[model samples]
Target chain A: MPSDALPDDPLPSWHDGRTKRAILDFIARVTKQGGPDYAPPAERIAVFDNDGTLWAEKPVYFQAQFALDEIARKAKENPALARQEPYRSVLAKDLKALTADNHKGLLQTLAVTHANMTTEEFASRVQDWLKTARHPVTKRPYTEMVYQPQLELLALLGKTGFRTFIVSGGGVEFMRVFADKVYGVPPERVVGSSDVVTFRMGKDGKPELYKTAKVEFVDDGPGKPVGINRFIGRRPILAFGNSDGDLQMLQYVTGGAGPRLGLLVHHTDGAREWAYDRKSPVGKLDKALDEAGARGWTVVDMKQDWKEVFPPAP
Target chain B: MPSDALPDDPLPSWHDGRTKRAILDFIARVTKQGGPDYAPPAERIAVFDNDGTLWAEKPVYFQAQFALDEIARKAKENPALARQEPYRSVLAKDLKALTADNHKGLLQTLAVTHANMTTEEFASRVQDWLKTARHPVTKRPYTEMVYQPQLELLALLGKTGFRTFIVSGGGVEFMRVFADKVYGVPPERVVGSSDVVTFRMGKDGKPELYKTAKVEFVDDGPGKPVGINRFIGRRPILAFGNSDGDLQMLQYVTGGAGPRLGLLVHHTDGAREWAYDRKSPVGKLDKALDEAGARGWTVVDMKQDWKEVFPPAP
Candidate 1:
């Protein structure tokens, strides 16, 4: 089918190519009447991994950067934080040195910086920060760095009776604040990592939020499938991802019976977007490459498939 | 509106006169365009408290009852629980004896009985128990004791485009198992109490669930509003409850600017269902009573409201 035949919305920007055709074909077949793959609107469940899949995840994860910045800000206020390695490293702007000691320091920084605030306060703070925060590498607002193709895909799926969800490794509380505005996926449908929070009486004797230094759940990789099962209770008929972090989620979705589609957003365009796959520490996509071919999953080559990358780069 | 006007469904056989009218009236107004307070279907968001609002809570919370039974069953095999107060009380069939101690013992029992199992195992166990477990007072299966009026309310709301959510204090995992079958509300829409759970590799090398003792979040009383705000984000225009635990939730919903409705289910028929309130230890309905009258919240007097209770009492 020609790209012109498709709705003149996001699909027009998809670039007439194999990857785009594969996705459009899958959606059309499933939604068409009398088609063997046709599923009722109620059963059109589609889940997407947020970080690298929908938005760019370069320099560092947006949440991790937030934690590091928060730690530094807190350390400046309290001299006691200088005594702490991770906090001190964060304060010194030495991400490499801080992470060199391994993930323990990172975890400690996350715990200290993320905890003790009420869930509401934390969410409001995240909302405030995201409004002003800019991605270091791209020099654009972090929200603006979101992939245009994926945004179009989300809208297309929604138009086709699919209820889309963001199942990511990012903090659920963090993504929930802006998901509705950016992705049209409501907070209820966005599931991700979370920390335990307590509802308690504030100083004024009104209910207030208090965060506990406990990991509630981490929705990533294998945890993604588990989170989906626990939270959604229904197997998604369609799934999308960009990294090894989403491999298990994609596998779980495509493994299910009935017409299912799994698509991987391969960052193959070096010019349009920073493209690093197998050797990249952040979004390593090696294992997924072998598995995608074996499982007949659609691998979206960003250079060949996407006509536009990040909302016309404006 | 006459009870005779209701369809020949089994629901009318259970709702009391006042409860029936409040439900029918709400439905009528929401569906009718020229009614005194008409609302479009999308604006209709109805939240129900699971324990007392949907099923039997007397004798003890159904989840608490399951925990105690599991504790006793484990104690019989392990013999270590004989030293524990609540487990010992549970073994002795003296649930009243544990009430003096409050929630600590109950928490301990829950941790031991509910944790360390795969999510599938826990869900299956809940489903199995729901199938066979009978309410001690009613001698009817716990599932059968569910309010037929509320079930009808759920169906009626669904028919009119209102999405019904089970907002309760019971474990979210526990409710997710049977909510779709019992309430017609899918698990994704069901918001309730939750504990931290982890995903691990199962024996077959597939991802499996492991429940943790850490309490993630509680969806009760004030927590109800927090959960609704965090999950749904949209303020519900309609709210229903039977106890003081629901007061804050109702306040949050009614505080919204647009057309709002709040209904308090008053158990005033001792013959059909337990009628004690205000002074009752379980589901206390005191402060809410004063607020309901002041706020113009609809209060359903079970004795005067409905012509029937408990779906034919079969």
Candidate 2:
């Protein structure tokens, strides 16, 4: 039967053929009346892993970079901080020395730099920094370097009665400040990690929560699925991710009854964007690669799939 | 000059007195052109305490009552819970026995009944219970018992371009599930206490978070102010509360520069509602009495000020 609905917009040179077709086909089937995978608008849920899935996450996760910078900035002003091991390493910009201590150093950096400010104040600082911060590799504003393919996917899904969500490992509060503007996903729809924030009366006589160093929740890998169920309360029929950190999420999404889709973005376009997998220090895509074929998951080869990696740098 | 925009519904009995007038007047001035307190619609923020301020917290908080009942129910089915101190007392329905253990019993009960469920499962359970549960005292659905005065006040504020937010010590997740339907406040605008939830792939092959027993954050008293600043960023020009739990919130709101209003709902209507102060175990209004007077906060005397209490029970 000829359909009355307009055809979805074609992905230009930006989106890889395989990835773009898989996404558009999924959306088309989900929205088409009487189609095998068709779902009503209420049930048309799509979730994407952030970090490497939506944007670049190397040489380090953006948030970790923020913490490293903050630790260095704070340590320069306080001699006590410079005396500390991880802080001292961060202050020296010795990335090699900092990683030698393993994840413990990362945790320490997060604890020291991300805590004790009013939530409003922290949000404001993040907003100010994001406004001017450029990606070290791309040299484009970090936000502008967001993947063009992913951006198109989000908008395309939205047009197909899909309610998209960013199921991320990044701080929920941090992403919340700009997600709506950047992704068109409202704050309430973005689920991620969070720290404890206690409400207090400020000098200005307004109620606010000061962000604490205390870890409230960590949303990553298995934690991603947990956060989705907790905050969203519905199983997404479609899920997209990059790296092993998203394996559990894909497993959960594709395991559902009836029609489901899971896609893994494989980094293989070093010419257009930095590419690495398996042994890479950040966004390692290993176990997921081994299981993709067996699990019937579509794997997107970045070099073949995405013609344009990122939007033109301003 | 007479206002042309006044509501024609004939103000509810709840808003026929001085307390209501103060709120309406503040709303009117803040929204009217050339008015001293006038603010643009985007900046018209108003925050309210949830428990006693929006709904009844009398006898005990609704969530506390739910926690206690859940413990008792579980204890009846499990031998292990019967061995625990607080659960042992709670299972016996011995309010006297439970009170003897104080906050310890309450915390233990909460830890058991509120944790371990998938976030989706928990939200569904809450939604189901809300549909059927009735207030112990009022014998009406808990949702129906929400303060009519506050409802009118919310509407009045909305008419004046203010965005109302619920800042409470209750679970933000719990309130979020129903706030939009009941109070016209969206989920994102509701801030409250929470526990850590970890995402995982469930047996059903979907991402879900298991609620943890550990406290993530406590949104009470001082926490209210902190939550406001963290979640809203902007300072509210008006605030309202019912007990000492809200003292910090009121302080924060009133402390802001320019025109601000703070009000406390004093339980003085023994005929229409329960009346108790300072010495009361629940919703204690002690420290806030002197603070309110000192800071020029409007204290609402329920019996004398409110001509009505609840809406016709649903």
Candidate 3:
């Protein structure tokens, strides 16, 4: 079948709604060769913000949870270390105290958890974490908490020759571990916040890239377009996100010449999933929400637009 | 046809010799299903350095020549600018004087030419330049000077399920302008030195990323492995290069825990192409040459390993 031809009910989980219609129409127009809005396969680039857009980001980001877990594991291994500032606070379950002073303690927790390991070792740890870690609220494996509609959308885009990429504020190495299996996006296609890594000959005489404590690049807010330009080297025609962090990415994608889409997956299903936005500390959606409305960008009300949330437990 | 199956004389321009044989053998081993060395398509990555490996890099590195030409063009547009230090030297054709003070003038030439422009505008300029720029010696269009044998090899690798990428010390945007058309590698797959880009809303209300003067990253020597890690995310199973700039990349690729091949293109054809290695100012192949020999990596003697150099003129 031609790539432009859609499979029957491709996004079955998405309900018949304005947002869904907009997405389908945009895909159809872009894929229709010789049409005025036609974009060639190379130009059919679509970027999706990971955390709250593709999966649940409630309680906290999955990556942050992973870091906290890593800290706990380390503290368990070395008991005396738990008596330290961040570790003591973490062990005492004092979230307020740990995040005080501009989240200094939390930043320290992230630093120790995220850096000072070989790239290979870091990847292995991420893989191992994903294998067993469960979402705090959902109690499902973090990967399993991914939205069914978003997964279907990703598949549909892939089938239509759109190179779907995860442009997230999440750690690139963390997301890369499961991006392929969960979203069908390869590691190279996953652009995110990253730490500076130095290359050196390991003790084993093999080349090893050690992740340093310094932040190299951050794919958040204004950094999104910069990251896209540096990594993808293409301005995506379609961009999807759930927060103010993705505002620049959506604007960058849609601002380019030709037909484009800028979508926001507004979390509005409090019962089915977390629905806090704007006021929510995690995945805040305020300025972007206003901009989306002003610009006629699709704003997906999670409860109204989606017939289903997470897929059935495997 | 299955990706593992090779066409008749897939690398037609490659002469039947040790380098070619090694390349073919490595590809076969990596592609053969159920074989111990077989790597899945996702794992079958091949990275090639641009300047001296895929194309000629003398009488000077092509990118440097491009910078010089850009400087001349700017000087021509604004005749008053010709009186300036770098511009004065460039306009007078005194390359030695311009590069006398630790390459201060040459660096300035690159800075003015390569940065402070929108990425779109920069891309357009590069496109315009490549359309007309000719090598000083051969006088052929720059893109047309790419090696036919290497081109054939890239095609062969793609056919054999390898995702080919260009990892160059050249500017990322500059290489990306011609990489797709000249080497079959996409823009995103081209990793190289880059200037930091700032994202902002343009006066036209569209998002624009402006290239800054500061060097964000340099993809040479040790920087090569870091570039590979950041951009490709996978340890390439096959790596090819022609200079010491690619030494760490070759080491990083071959050092991975897998069946791998690190190949170097030695400029041994002074008759067909300029041959000045080890002591050559441009694309010096001293340390990498020694390392390649010691590691038993395949080293292509350009005169012996290929039947053709550049493709026929259009």
CA RMSD of all predictions: 5.9, 5.0, 1.7
Tens digits of per-residue lDDT, candidate 2, B1-314, equal 13556556424756466766776677667777787877877668899998888888888888877776667666777878687877777866767765565567667677777888876667776787788777888888778878887888887777667788888989877887788889988655687888887756568655556888888668887877766655565678898998898998888788877788999989888888889889888889999988987898999888877777888854
TM-score of each: 0.77, 0.78, 0.97
Q: Global lDDT for candidate 1?
A: 0.78
Query: What DockQ do the predictions score, one after another?
Result: 0.29, 0.31, 0.84
**Per-residue lDDT of B116 in model 2:** 83
Give the runs in model 3 whose Cα sits over 4 Å from its true position.
A1-6, A95-97, A100-102, B1-6, B93-97, B100-102
Superposed by TM-score, candidate 1 places the C-alpha of residue B84 at a distance from the truth, in angstroms, of 15
Cα lDDT tens digits, model 1, B79-180, are 986877667866876656755566566666787777778766888888877777778888887777787777777786776668888888888888888888
lDDT of 3 by residue, B5-56 (tens): 6677888898898888898888889888999999999999999999889998
Q: What is the lDDT of residue A70 in candidate 1?
A: 74
lDDT against the true structure, per candidate, is 0.78, 0.77, 0.89
Q: Provide the lowest-lDDT 10-residue window in model 3 chain B.
A: B1-10
First chain TM-score in every candidate?
Answer: 0.92, 0.90, 0.96
* Most accurate candidate by TM-score: 3
lDDT of 2 by residue, A30-61 (tens): 88789887787767788988888888887788
Among all candidates shown, the one with the greatest lDDT: 3
Clashes of each: 7, 18, 0
